[model samples]
Target: MVVVRGALVLSLVALLLGLSAGPATAQGPKPTIVLVHGAFADSSGWRDVAANLRSEGYPVQTFDNPLRSPAYDSGQLEKQLATISGPIVLVGHSYGGFVITNTHDPDVRANVYIAAFAPASGEFVQGLLNPITYPGSRLLPPALQLKLVENDPTGIGGRNIDGYIARPYFRDIFAQDVSPAVAADMFAHQKSAALVANLEPSGAPSWATVPSWYLISTQDRVIPPALQRFMSSRAAPGRTAAVDASHASLVSRPADVTAIVLAAATAVQR
Candidate 1:
């Protein structure tokens, strides 16, 4: 519940995003900003955010996270990180945060979570499921719709399943803060994540050693704002910010999200 304003307000983005770091980087080049999207959405959701970052002269790449198990997805992201040079400011939104939590990428100088899940060791991002644990979260049954897909072989048989936010509840749960047109567009383009992702337990969180940041969306109907506060506090982030936006604040308020990313990037560049 910390209030940030003026110059210090800018500094809070790193802590708000739940990025906890040990030491400042020695003189180095600007780190590449790598963004990971979460469930029910695709890289397209980051279209505005990436454009803003690139406009700031940052090298930004929105990773098309395969909506699979955390372990498998993290492996994919780790491989992608290895191909890129220099340090990285790894950012994630929603379940994408769950995926990033499992990575141990050394080049990742800072972690920025934008209304995303930042789970701890052995913690499942599915913690969102407990109504008692995370009050006010409406991302539950009925609001969520699951579709079965074949040819995935990684399921309980030779089939797979994906979860999508029901169209009727999509705006209410994920993007109530945005305009109807934008929210509808987002829903139209949203991609489903593997339902098994909710079942996978997170490994040792990378934020512990990589320095992390968190941006909590106060009006978030997806993940409770209380949960965001809990996660950010648990991470012991060096900086943090609370925005009165929805879970899709990254869409309605990309600037706020970018401020946190910039703070993390500046911290790593130092």
Candidate 2:
């Protein structure tokens, strides 16, 4: 009887210890952060942001997002997310937002939108920039340069027109806050997004079911600040922040972007 009682007491003591421990005891390791870049840009644009996340001990991975259709890009991302066994924080910039939003990854702890598109079901990227719908956007036909993709190497259907920011207006529309030297470099490395990518109807947004956070760029010209406010509010995100930045907030304001992403990480960490 004494032996049994002692065993029960020990079990009780262990239970008490666990109950007294902080949230960290129940929390898993730091989540892997996956950043997806949108149209007209590539993964290299996330170097500074990824570096900041890495410094905080996060396992950071940046996607070389195919400027293909949203569903296709989401499928591409799924292949990478499959390798991660733990929690994940998905961060998207610009067109990258549509890609992340289309994901249904169960391990995604949070979706963070950095001056990105958080579109609704059946919404097209091009429609969002219509001044009649959400004014102040400089993404009209005049600001874009459409070129034919001869072979459609990314499998976005052959001979599709790819939309690129016009050379003269690239800096002003995309990264107004970035230095001229850096902006010029960014422009030179631009990736033209397939026209179908903008025209394709986005799948159901993960934001509808998953927790989300948004960092609105007040000085954004690519996506109007007002539209950012509307979309973030529509998502009913758990957290939202604003920065005095252009459309390339993730590049120009890496620290701010990192902070918001960190907030999402910390929330799920507990």
Candidate 3:
């Protein structure tokens, strides 16, 4: 009788302890961060941003955007996402925004756009700037200022071609706020984006369903600040921050970009 009573008491104690400890148990694994660079820039642009994220204890990955068609680039990114086991915070800059828009990966917990093109369904990067009749359209005559270095015939329908910013215009348009020396070096190494990548229409934007954040670069000459504001408002992102940096804010203002990315990462933790 005494043994039975003791067993019952012990069982009750164990149940109470389990219930009390439930909320204190470990949460699931942390989400990994995937940084996608925009056109003309390589993964090297994300070096500072990635470093900051890693310092914050985040598992970071930087994907080199092929600057190909939206569908093709997104498809490639989707493959990379498949390799990650935990949740992801997918971040895109400039043309990279269009790539992430097409990705409907289930593991993406949040989307972050850094002075990028957040096109809606049926809208392409060119279409966004094509309608701009005013002089404020920074990208209207991008080809004229960008020097053509290569004529790679590997793009979609052989229509897409690559071009880099001319040394003279590189500092003014792409990285206005960056030092002259750094801008020159960046211009020298800048990869030419396939022209078709900007012309192709975006599929259903993942931002439509997933939560989003935007880091608008007010001084951005590639994608104008007004356009960034318009797109960000249209998406109704969870958070929006504006910085005084240029289009290369990822490199010029890494801390600001890192903060917004970290916010998205922190939110997904809850």
Candidate 4:
């Protein structure tokens, strides 16, 4: 199933480049693509991108972020980062960008931000929520809030979220790159509540030190493309690439996202 999708997406990418899907077998490095999903979603959301990346010969590992507290997820990520023997490229989406940036190990060869939040020192991920009014934050049902509170003390994290409220209110953080079907799937698979409390800012911002790349989803509904650009600028990545997709650009336009990740990885290799 994914092979067909990969072939199609890759072909489209080739066409965009004014080239055919030539016989050229692009050999990518062996380093793994460690994917960290954002709030309201789990690792499965990365399945589509992972499959396409594998087709390009890149090893990928999508983590099931506890979605509990940022600190806890960081611990989990640290444990995973310990197991990989080769160099690694850390990728994050939305709030997951905070997770990747905050929990980064000195060993990470590169970092990739896909319309994700990359906060700096002493900045909490939830601090960005300041723009959201208290009543607005309460847009989530109380029942849902309780569920998220259970998984993450900060009232964040869970995949069981679904309903009309999500569609009209929550769907746009991602750009128009993703199809309705894919957006629906992501909403269904989103983690309930990711703890924003006790979520400290990045200890060692990867953008400041690591070879980093940023993929901006111009049409993102959630994080606002403007905010993404501001954050990327602060991080000072090696390069920045723009895509006309949603927040879930990795899923909606995996080829472009993959290219950005590959570029980051290639720089690390150099």
| Top lDDT model | 2
Worst 10 residues of 2 by lDDT: 1-10
Candidate 4's C-alpha runs over 4 A off are 1-29, 129-177, 195-199
78 Cα displacement, candidate 1 (Å): 0.9
lDDT per residue for candidate 2 within 56-125, as digits (tens), equals: 6789998888888998899999999999989999999999999999988999999999999999999988
lDDT of 3 by residue, 1-270 (tens): 001122233233324322221221125556899999888788888888888777666899998788877998999999999999989999999998999989989999989999998889999877787544313545535433434434445544444446556666777888888889888777776877777777889999999998888889988877878889889997644367788999999888887787777666766665
Error of 2 at 24 (Å): 9.4
TM-score per model over all chains: 0.89, 0.88, 0.84, 0.76
Off by over 4 Å in 2: 1-26, 153-157, 236-238
- Could you tell which candidate, 1 or 4, scores higher by lDDT? 1
Give, for candidate 4, the lowest lDDT window spanning 10 residues. Answer: 134-143
Model 1 lDDT tens row, 182-210: 88999998888787798888888888888
Per-residue lDDT of candidate 4, residues 1-270 (tens digit):
243334455455444433345433445445788999877677877776787678767788988876555667778899999998778989998778877887767678878898888788777755654544311232334323433133323333433222222555445544345667777887787665433422555566666777667788887766666777778877744367689886677777776777666556545554
Q: With candidate 1 superimposed using the best TM-score fit, by how many Å does residue 226's alpha carbon deviate from the native?
A: 0.5
- How far is 26's C-alpha from truth in model 3 (Å)? 9.3
Error at 187, model 1, angstroms:
1.0
Highest TM-score among the candidates is held by which one? 1
- lDDT of model 3 at residue 12? 38
After superposition, the stretches of candidate 3 with alpha carbons farther than 4 Å from their true spots are: 1-28, 131-135, 140-160
Ranking by lDDT: 2, 1, 3, 4
Could you tell me which 10 consecutive residues in candidate 1 have the lowest summed lDDT?
1-10
Residue 265 lDDT in candidate 4: 56
lDDT of each: 0.81, 0.82, 0.77, 0.66
